[model samples]
Structure formats: structure tokens, C-alpha cells
Target: MTSTSGARSHTSPWELYDGLTALVPRGVTVTTCVVSRWALVETDAGGAGLSSVPDDGRDDPHGPQDVVGQDLADVAALVRSWDRRLAAIGLASINAWCNTQERLEAHAGDVIDWDASAFERSGELVQGRRVAVVGRFRHLDQLASRCDLTVLERRPQGRDLPDAAAEFVLPEVDHAFITSMTLANKTLPRLLELSGGARTTLVGPSTPLAPEAFAGRVDEISGSLVYDAPWCRRALMQGQGMASMRGALTLFNLRVPA
Candidate 1:
């Protein structure tokens, strides 16, 4: 008989939020928060974090769009308490902000500067397996040449499959590369559910490095850390993307312990 256990194998954003919030100690105050091309948060403790700013401001279900004036600690605490569908992007940024501080204080030793490319690490794992990529990446051309690959984009472009294909194609693949923006869009849980037996990985600049948040559901978490918050903020405020801003970021990866 197939053994049925406790909650199904998936990482709920709320679960991640709970795990993340537990690490945040009291008395830490938010020093600054800016939402431009990128959402940025800096705590009084000199820790900073960045994320893709949420769009659809008009459709945000959480009260108003004026989160600019709220308390950082209060906003961070409320992030875990809200329904995932409400003001999702904003919540994602807030979570990233809180997680940055928490990781700086607690997991400082675990955060290391990565010299290798994330695509190389991903390519090594999918050697002979079919691959399903959830978001478009510039390095995809390298991977496509080696294996059968399907790329699903929210806005289908060129050869990319539409988002609907995720449910149909993900289960059949041997490995998957899912974007960390899924958390901002409130699709991470569902994507993880669709991942099935694939060695699934969450990849992007927006991903949080909170291992406890990912736990068993994710095989790897590849994301960025703010190396120079002031520079990043200035570029973001000037409408430049992450790539346009140099020396402001560092890439990092966390493999889930087996």
C-alpha cells in the first residue's frame, strides 16, 4: 500500500513565513524601504535586502497602497499573517526585507560569495534528464542544447510554453528550474505541488536564503544578497535593473541537506 503521511509534500509560503519570522528578534527597526524597479529594505542594524517590486498596485487586496508609512516590524509581522493572495508582491518584498535582517544576524557564516554560475550548477544536475524551466533565463540556450527542455513563461514569448503547460509538463520532467518570483506572484506552493518527483530548484534574484523556509520541498535555493545596499538603492531609484548595477550584489546558493 502507498503510505500516506502528514501534510502533503509542498512548502506553503505561510509555512515559510512562520519559519522566517521566528528568527526575527524584537527591537530591530526598519531604517528605510523603497519600492521602485526593485523593492529595498535596510534595517537599523545595517542589514539590507532587495526583491522585485510588486506590480498590480490597483488590485492589491491589502487595505491601501500606502505601506510606505508603516512600521517595518509591524509590516514584517503582518506579512506572515495575511492570505497569500492579498498584496502578494508587497508582502514578498516585506518578507525579503525581514529575511535579510534575520539571515545577517543568524546565518552570517552560511552566506558565502559564489564564484560559479547558477546555470552551471543547474546544468550539472540535469545531465541526462528532461528539464522544465518555469521562467525565461538568458543562459537557457546553453542548457537547451544538451537536453530536452521546456520553458514556461507567464507571458509566452518566442519558443517559451505558456504558463498553463506547467501542470501538464512539470510532472513528466526529471528536473525543473522554477523562478523565486513565484513567491511574489503567489504561485510557489502550486508550482512545488506540480514539481512531483523532479529535483526542483528555485532560482532568481528575488529568492530568500532562509533554508528553514524552503525545508524539504526545494532541492536548492539560488538567490542574491545585497552587498552594497546604498549603490543598489541609487541604481534602483534611477530605474536600472540588477544587471546594470555592478558591485552592489553577490550571488549565493543553498542546497537542502539530504
Candidate 2:
């Protein structure tokens, strides 16, 4: 088990944000945007993307509710905001723009498997190798037998390392399965650097499936594309968690071409 020696970016969010902002259509007003316990947005074309926003957003005073009718390009720019609530909404917009709104960007030579989970795919490749899953995703138990596995979380639970341990742990791993929330928290750039040459997959529903945005930054993109926007929006508004997304979402993996 070994980690790669350089970083994809010491400065992140911008390089990634720049790529996504360029992809989102200009002047297209978003149809729906909400941030209660979860942040979600839908493009005018029925595309939906979701983010886990823990804050109730009731007291933020300044929020992105006005983003519904705003230019998406300007909305996408919010991903760079330092305010956590604003950043959460911004990420939701980017996910909606990149994954759902721009589904036509099937880059040539890129292969997307619609029925696979990132956990399963990552497990297949980590046999007897060192792996670090930066989020506390379920099913790590299934992977423990095949690899030297480690789990890190912002709120450490069980044996998982604290998120800060990435500086020490990521540089020594072979594969890093990073959570998409790293983008919202603006920790992704540094995490990528720590993972260096290690094969990496940006894993979560919050991930923007923009290959161009992540070219050379990651090896694979594993995320969900919401097929039923209304259903997801309703669910998010009704306080449903990710586990309750009954058939409204489809998980996919896009293997970035080398």
C-alpha cells in the first residue's frame, strides 16, 4: 500500500469551480431551490441535484432563496463563498447544473455505468491495498476484508480518524474515496494534494458529474443524478433523508479516461 507523491491542487474550489461555471448555461433561471435541513435545486429542464445541508437555514438572514430566478452562472459562483450556508446552496446549484441540467456532456471516451455504486467499484480495486474513505459512508465493513481500510469523519465516530488526519494519512494511501462535501467545505484541494498520485474517486450524491471540472484531479466520479425532480424536491422539503429517496435517484460512476 502506497500513496502518490504530489497534489492535484493545493488551491482547490477555484480550479474546480472555474470548470463548472463555464459549463453551466448562462441566463437560465433555476426553477426551484430550497434549503431546510437539506439543500436542493432544480434546473428549468427538470434536472435535480441535492446536498446535505445540516443547518435549518432559518436564521441565516441572508440566504440563496432569491437564486431561483437568478442567472445560474452567477448562482454557481456561490460555491466559492466562505459562508457555510451560502456555500451549501452554491454546491446544490452546481450539482443541479452539472449533473442534471447538463446531462448531454457525455465526454467522448468517458464511460458511465448507471447501475453501480462507488462503494462496490472502489472495493473491487482496493484488494489488499491501502484505502481511505474520507466520509463515514456505510458499507465500509464490506471493504475491510479486501483492503487496509480507514474511515475519517469530521465528527469522529467509532474507530474512524478525525478529518484532520488526512494530512498524515492520505499521503500514504493507494486509493482515496473522498466525500463530495469536501467541495462545500473547501477542503478538497488540500485533500487532493495529500492523496497526490493516489487513485481518487469523488464519492457522494453532492458531486458534480463534470469530467472537465475534475480532469487530472480525480480518476473516477461516483454520484447520483435525480431523475424525478419534483419527488426529490418534495422529499427534501418534507424533511426526508437520503435513505428515503425511493426510485427518485439513480447512482452512477463515470470513469475518467486516462
Candidate 3:
């Protein structure tokens, strides 16, 4: 693990938004959570929306709720309205308890740029190509099924970063995806550095627009454009340890300048 010197501090949505407002980037949106709903902040552009998730009709500990699912339609609408230059959208739903990796793999042919079916179902190799993925969870084996793909896990603690940084020694790759939760641990910059020379993408809401931190480092960032609810955060905070929040937020994605 790599070590940084700083005390962990709790952040409110307002504070997080304020910090991001100071360094907005072109063609990017920052999404954070409100109460039971989500909010979108297009720093470079100007638009906002909400998301929907599947409902189990179960009462939430926080209170009664209408379980709206991920608004993929609305997301696509935003991209279209943005003139299609929106390269990618960052989502942080992983923290919201969404299992997006499986969703992505299930819809690989439709969602991913390449033929993810071979990778997901057969674990077949996409020959002569290299790929990078940050944030390790249950989907690693499926991702590793692609013989040509090299998976690098990024886990940043408050003080120490993951040892996976050394894997960046590989020459380069075709694509890269990062998780926004890296913001909570402040390891996005380091992960971007590791993706050097690759057509990199950051895939988490925690991604910040401090371009200088990733300039000459990565090529793109992708994640959810919104954050999770305060209730979700409170639930995680009230957990026995960090496990609950970790479990909830793993379902989404986001992106930033890498």
C-alpha cells in the first residue's frame, strides 16, 4: 500500500459540489445524491435530471420510498441533447447498491464499444487488445475472461494506495475505465498516472475536474453523472464498518479527465 498524509474528513453534498464547481471541465457532469433522489450538475454545460431504479416494494429503513431505477433512457436523452459530443457519462451507482458490472456484461453488445458477449459469456480473448479496469469487486473473473484484457484493481485507502500501481508498466492499452468512488479515497490521480498512454476513461462520480492532475495521463473518464442519497450515505455510515457503503455504491459509474 502507498501512504498519504492527511486525516479523513466527512463531506456534505454542498461541500463536494462547491469544491467541484471551482474546477468544472468541458463536456462533463457531476452527479451527487440528495435525499432519496439523485441530482445532476453539468459543470461545463447546463442541464439537470433524476434517475430511476427497480423497486422491490420493500420499505426502506430510512422511510417509505418509490424505488426508481437507473434512468438509462434519460441518460441517453441527455447525451443526445448534448449533441452527442458528451463522449461519456460518469455514474456512481455502485455506491448506490447497483450491480452495474453484471448489467454491463448482460448488455455488453449494446453498451460496450466492443463485442463484450465473447468476453462475458465465454471469457474469450479479444485478441491484440489491452484493457484497464479500476476498482475490484465480484466481476473481476468475468472481466479477466478476455485473454487479451489485463485487469488492474484500484483500491485507495485514506492513507495508503493499492500496490496495483506497478501494473501500469505495460506499454499501453486500447481502453481504460475508473470508478468515481476513488474520490472518497483521493486516488484518482494516481490511477490516471498508471493508465499512461492508454485511451483511458475514468468511471466514477468521485472523479474531479482538476485536469492538471491527469493531463498527459489518461484519455477519458466515465461514471454516473449523479451521486447517491444522504439516506444511503447515512446507512453506510451507520454500518458496522465501511462494508455497507462499499456495497451500496458499487452499482454505478462516473468519469473525469484522466
Candidate 4:
């Protein structure tokens, strides 16, 4: 959730990126080259045409051309030509949003409860600890509340990292729970970096549980065990996105030994 849209028409990717890039934040900038590559492939396979018009499209006085309805492969080729630029822009926008604090306080008091589908099966491991949640989505709140939690409504800033919510302020708190959606915005590594020294845990369906991939990154994993999804398989084939997909509730403990 990047909320760049206002009361007007839909916000273009450039507009959203421009609005976010104004702020600077201290977090690892995760480049979404893979997503860009996939998007290019999708466009190619789907046959969306490429446009020669500027991003805003208003600058082209001759007006925009009908790049749509072209061959899918041609569309994919055009996307490949512009993939780097698109990825750069997307990363910058993510950096901007990561630094903003505007949305951090929006749902501060929302209560989180457990959903039988995801966490109950793991038993009562989260019975009496304060938890801080990241990411924005309707169903996520349910999971957080079950853990007796508070929402970390931190919005991504253009430059500065969003403030971790009140629950994270408790130095004695037992755990910090993050979501797989963080991967969508390229903030998973940054979130790990922020929770580096704390008693935190990564809970999502997208985490890779291999000791080699997560040895120094996380402590324990708890979520869906997704080892057989088509996109995931493809990502593995392409040397990326190989994490399992256990129905979107994979949980990984982030404990490190002293």
C-alpha cells in the first residue's frame, strides 16, 4: 500500500513515484528487477502494446499513439527495452514510501485476533506477548489481533523509514511480526534490518526456510509451507522467487544466538 492517489483521477505510476521520492529514509533499497521482468513477460504473453509517449503523456504534443492491441511478444519486447528504467522508478518510489511516517499512526489501536486457518494450528505460542504488525490489508489485522497486538500503520516515506509502532518501542516485548506482502514493495530485507537486534519474527507465506538462505536473517519460520505453486516453480527455474507458499501464513522466527 502506497497511497499516492488523491480525490482526482487514478494516479499514474510516475506520479506516485514522484510523490514518494521526495523523502529520504534509512532502509535497504530492494530493487524489484524480478517483478519487472515478470511484468515484461506477462505483457508479452498478454499482448499489451508499448507506448512511445512520455510518462505523463501530456508532453507529447502530437498526442499518444495506440500502442495497445499489438502482438503480445512485441509488447513483451518493448517492456524488456524499458525494464531497467521501470525498475529504477519503482525502487525509488518504494524507498520514498518506506521513509514516510504519515500512515504509521492510522490504525494504531486496531485489535488483532487469530484466524483458525493460519495460526491456531501452531498452538498457543503467542498467548501473552505484545506484537507489532507491518503491512496493510484487511485480513492481516485479524492475525495481528489474535496475537494481542497493535497495528504499525507506518506508511513508506520517500526518504526516511516509517516509525515502528508503539508495540515495537517496548524493549522487553517478545516478538515482532512482519508479512510477506513486504516483499511486494521490496521492503522485506529492510524490515529484517530494522528488526535485526530485536526479538522479532517473520511471518508470511513467501519466506524461504533453507538454512543457507535464512541462516543469519531469521530465527524460526511459521507459516504455510508452499513448495508447489506454478509461479514459485517458475521463479525457482529462473533463479528467483523460490520461497514456499503455505496459503499466505508462513511464519519465521527471527532469533539469533549470542
Q: Give the number of the best model, judged by TM-score.
A: 2
Which segments of candidate 1 are over 4 A away from where they belong? 1-13, 54-71, 77-113
* Residue 227 displacement (Å), model 2: 0.3
Q: Top model by lDDT, which number?
A: 2
Local distance difference test, candidate 2: 0.76
Q: What is the C-alpha RMSD of each candidate to the true structure, in Å?
A: 4.5, 2.8, 14.0, 16.1
Report the Cα lDDT for candidate 3: 0.35
lDDT of 3 by residue, 1-258 (tens): 111211112233233323333332233433433223222222212222222221122223454222133333233222211111111222222222222243335433333332121124323333345665555434555555554555444444442235365364333555555554443333445554555545555543344323333333444333332233343446533533223333333222222222
CA lDDT of 11 in candidate 2? Answer: 54
Look at candidate 1 and give me any clashing residue pairs.
none
Poorest stretch of ten by lDDT in candidate 1: 1-10
Q: Model 1 Cα displacement at 248 (Å)?
A: 1.0
Residues 170-220, candidate 1: write the lDDT tens digits: 778877788876776667778777775677777877777776666667777
Model 3: ten consecutive residues of lowest lDDT: 79-88
Which candidate, 1 or 4, has the higher lDDT?
A: 1
Residue range 168-241, candidate 2, lDDT tens digits: 99888889999988887788888887787798888888888787778778888888888787777787779887
Count residue pairs with overlapping backbones in model 4. Answer: 44
Worst 10 residues of 4 by lDDT: 46-55
Tens-digit lDDT track for model 4 on 201-224?
445433222222333454443322
